[model samples]
Target: MFFKWVMLSLLLSRSLASQQEEDVGFTYNGFRGVNMSLDGIAQITESGLLLLVSTTWAQVGHAFYPQPLHFMNSSRGNALSFSTTFVFAMFSELTTVGGPGIALVISPAKEFPGALPSSFLGLFNMATIGKPSNHLIGVELDTLQNEEFNDINGNHVGIDINDLKSVEAVPASYFSDQENRRIDLNLFGGQPMQLWVEYDGIEKQLNVTLAPINVPKPTIPLLSLKIDLSRYMVDPMFVGFSSSTSALDVSQYVLGWSFRMNGQAKDLSLSQLPKLPRRGTKTKPNFLKIGFPVFGASLVLMLVFIIQFIVRRRIKYAEVLEDWELEYGPHRFKYKDLYIATKGFNEKELLGIGGFGKVYRGMLPNSKEEVAVKRVSHDSRQGMREFIAEIISIGKLQHRSIVKLLGYCRRKGELLLVYDFMPNGSLDKFLFDHLSTTIKTKLSWNHRFQIIKSVASALLYLHEEWEQVVVHRDVKSSNVMLDKELNGRLGDFGLARLYDHGGDPKSTHVVGTFGYLAPELSRTGKASPCVDVFAFGVFLLEVACGRRPIEAGASEECHVLVEWVISSWSRGEILETVDPKLEMNYEVEEMELVLKLGLLCSQYIPTARPYMRQVVRYLDREIPLPELPSLSKSISLPSEMSTCGDISMWSPYYLGSTMSTSSSVADSLLSGGR
Candidate 1:
């Protein structure tokens, strides 16, 4: 019963349209030199209209009636209707996935200002890709599957209200004798197809019918919808065909077209329409005839230019390296090789994270040697400069107590540094993992003592034993790694600076872990070997107490570990400050000596702190402990040296000032003043 009613309504609409000859508004049998606007590469040919040229990788074409149609206040009625029939063909030379397809569009403007090519069907772009625009409506013959737009398949027809996403769609086919036959049409396969679109103003209905060229029009339309165009369309609108192609290219052409408004134009005779032009005979511009050879030559030249650029860049990069960088002992690993070694930097291989970046566990392919790869964050302001500094500072320096830098890698925005994997991890984990009950090796007092002595040795080498005085700006517990045997190896030279024996180490930036920063450095923004000593002092206290340098929950006087130890010592309760986890098993006198030495090294006055050499000797029992001033009697730094002042005013001379040979040895060691 419903099918009968639908067939009756369609028949009545056609009959009424045919009878209203006097109400005709406009008509077109074909687009041959007609006054129509074209966008992209659309052109009028002797046969019909070619919407998209076949030679381009991606293209868009649009054709619209030169005069806008009147749909707002027509003589027939305020409401208006239209009917159009068109034959289209798509062809591609390449035997690959083809098409993007075409649309029968009603738009307010003759030219789509921001329409995009490819799957967008020359209608939208990233800014408005999925949004409605220009009060547009389209009946689309989509011949490509776009997952982002939820296309049904490579061949389907859709009704797009305003956006590219279809409101209603179905596979491109027509019903014949109560059986549906799929359209064997492909844009690149040169199969021509026909479509009929009709709108009824009174019923506000849109009907679309389709069939093969040789087959008769089906009794039932492939799709029908009751859509009110008055709400989406304006007074003057362009009725046209729009089509596009993407990387998978295809040519879309309209051989014949007919459109009638006000339900009055005569129906087009499909058999009488001119045939489509044969392939390869279509006229092209003289320049386009030679474009292939020109494009080929241009592509070859571009390839050569790219190769020369890469070669020149490599040579320039090599030339830019300092003489010392060329002699650096560390190997330079390829970024791809390291990326594969770390299993593409999967989370499962992540070892730890620091301020600058994360560290991952990896193994070399040839050697199968375990390594730790530090991948620095691209946004870090200091990461690149520090990477270069680390290579220059420790690339060739070898010592048992210093962690070896295996190699480095740079690719695009990524910076990676490779080092031997420390199975035991960093010291902070052992120092702070007080609540975990999981079975794992713990750092005993003896191991802690050995680590302290080893770190001291590393510092001693960096300060005086090496050819240059190296100032490690960051020396927190996390920067100290533990080997398989619990031996300490100082690592992370991202902030280290090098200076000759009598040259100044001018530093501009005041950088270091917050709790470990020397009091004098905050005010001066200057770094010296004494800064390392102050940080080591904080590390020593943390190791002995098994507590952080700064704790929020501690009593006011005990907020800082240094203050807490000093307070405890003043009250004749120094032993009480030791880690309870040690269970009184440590030697009492040695613990007291180390604790006091840490306090003496962390004094507010920079000159009061003992050198790394003296501390190492004290730890090794090679020298008797020197008399230390009581905490109250210790000299204090000037008021100006209390906190970092305005950093913008800090001079760069603090980083690389020249030094005079006549300067005192103490000044040379503490401030790089020769």
Candidate 2:
């Protein structure tokens, strides 16, 4: 129904609108005096009109009349064709002074029958201008040599006076073949000067003023000559300019043009001319022609200078320790000084290994600052790259429970990271081995609850408040380091991946400890916020039950601990699942809520798990309790519920119970009353 309405609206819009063509403009400048004529060919295609020409001598002409000339043909009602009207003008005043016209006949319907390979045809009228306009006629030329028009017999054919014969009639008849009227050629005699083609070959160029009386000059100057051709002949057939004189000794001055019997026009020799401006004689240089190559060389030199400047700047900035002390403290030293202070990386200075790298305890020589120098292995495959990325990704991470990263060092290959040493060590020491029973005894139920919240806040940092949302894939108890006050500090992000909002979800290789890994990793191989939720569930179960994900000698039933937590919680017997050290020290309501959150996180489906923000809210009482998880008995218990029957006895009391007397006592009381 929605698609139907959209279609209807589209139809209504189409009915109200129509398509139209918008006029576009292009530029050219060649065939002068014939207002806006172009020297190249113009053709039409599906994408509208295109004019191809060279800029040196070729120019485009604008249509004086409307293009695609439409007219009534009387028989056909309308004729569609393209045509142009032009007036040719010359640039200089050196040659003929006479009025003679030309005829231009365009035959769109005629074809030369079997004469040439492509039915080629040409016509020649006179040989005066660059290339005669006569090559487009029906006749084919035999031979052309030395600017002379030769016949089949190798004899020169002079120009016909038919164009001058019709000069007395109207100019419109110049396109007509109507005979019976003729015109005469009259010209003024004068000495012909040496004419040359002048060009700037640069920006400014000359424009044509007059055409009929001008003749192009040659490169070499020579003597001038005079001739007038009206004394020679009449009733001519040529279509070019000619001169005649009725003055004294007119027969001594004879000017005529030669024409070929089978005619063809010559192409313009425009490409041979130099494009640079002729500023001076042969010895002087032309600046315009040389400028482009010089500018190109200058640009290359400037680029090399810029690259050298940047390399030198990086060398000066390599003294990083000077700025490091300002951001951190004054005790920071460069890598060279640290080598001397640690006595050449001796084994005695080595601290235990952290996820980042092996930590080395170092003491400054003259100062009193004792620091833990984490000597990250340059060959450790995981070192400064991950460290630097984590610092950049977590720049605005403001959570109090997450560990703080001080300023770092980027030396040659080795990374000497300095961090606040946690004196009490990590949570794994107490939970896994029960080593140092003193610390284990000190870990009470209250301390355990605080640790749970602290870790949740740290996950909240990784999930929401950081500059980029970070996934701490390895979030087991081993990664939760404890500071002096036993506060949990989340660490170990070597396998971490970051996702900004609206970015693609992180696709990763299947990593992290096997038991704590999210189920979706096996299917999708992608890390979302739910991945961290899965790891947090395992951590929560570990802190509450004091159980590792996989017991050393356990069967398949004990391998996945999340399945055991849910089974024990749903039977109203979660107390049996609590850490044995607690011994009823923890609150029952809080335990139920924490167990529910873990169950929600450990859902086999990724979408069912809540975000870390939601997990933190549910723990802090900002939201209501979620639904109880459905437990399947197909999952065998690692350890049987020791107190389920005991807790079931209290459920009825909590729901309000009923009391009744025995039948025999009721019967005796009734008889006594009677």
Which number leads on TM-score?
1
TM-score of 1: 0.47
What's the C-alpha lDDT at position 88 in model 1? Answer: 75
* Reference-based TM-score, model 2: 0.41
Best by lDDT: 1
Taking the tens digit of each residue's C-alpha lDDT, what string does model 1 give over 83-152? 8787777776444445677899888876775555767788765345544455888999887777556788
Model 2 scores a C-alpha lDDT of: 0.41
State the lDDT at 412 in candidate 1. 43
Which window of 10 residues has the lowest lDDT sum in candidate 2?
665-674
Model 1 lDDT-worst window of ten: 665-674
- Compared with the true structure, all predictions reach lDDT values of 0.70, 0.41
**True-structure RMSD, every candidate:** 22.2, 36.7
Give the per-residue lDDT digits (tens) of candidate 2, residues 435-468: 6655644577677778888888888777777677
